[model samples]
Target: MTHRRAREAAGDKDVLVLGVDVSRQMLGSGLLDEVHLHLMPVLLGAGAPLFAGVRAELLPLGEPVGGAATHVGCSVVFGP
Candidate 1:
């Protein structure tokens, strides 16, 4: 589901939805304009597939933006 549609469905101005992870069915619905991924460089033998639905290559947006999580950020194409 697109962010706008999800927001409208919930009838709330602020709605947090999960866009990543393999479980999510919607990824490249051509609804979003941009997609951000803050990932840690690690090799987990088994876990939730990263960018399972993400097809486009990620491009660095700017300098490393850090938060509670230590990760390297990249921007991926959201739509055509």
Candidate 2:
């Protein structure tokens, strides 16, 4: 889906809902212009799936973004 449609589906002003991609051993976030709420429960277990596509460059939320995944153990990474 296009990034613009994604945001309109999210319907939020203060928060930017993008995409989160997860592979066999890697997790990454994307900065799409929008995020589709309809796809929240969708999961791709093969290869590196695209969480979202953005037309512009994605900006990082901070220097270091840390998080805890129930299945991935401890993970510390940056977001864009």
Best by lDDT: 1
The CA lDDT of each predicted structure is 0.53, 0.36
Candidate 1, poorest ten consecutive residues by summed lDDT: 17-26
The C-alpha stretches of model 2 lying farther than 4 A from their native spots are 1-44, 51-55, 69-80
RMSD to the true structure for each prediction, in A, is: 4.6, 10.0
Report the lDDT tens digits of candidate 1 across residue range 1-80: 65667768878454544534522334445443334555566646665764566556667667666675555545556534
Candidates in order, TM-scores: namely: 0.44, 0.25
Candidate 1 residue runs with Cα over 4 Å from true position: 1-4, 7-16, 22-24, 40-46, 66-68, 78-80
lDDT score at residue 35, model 1, on the 0-100 scale: 48
Which candidate should be chosen as best, given TM-score against the real structure? 1
Question: What is the Cα-based lDDT of residue 31 in candidate 1?
Answer: 41
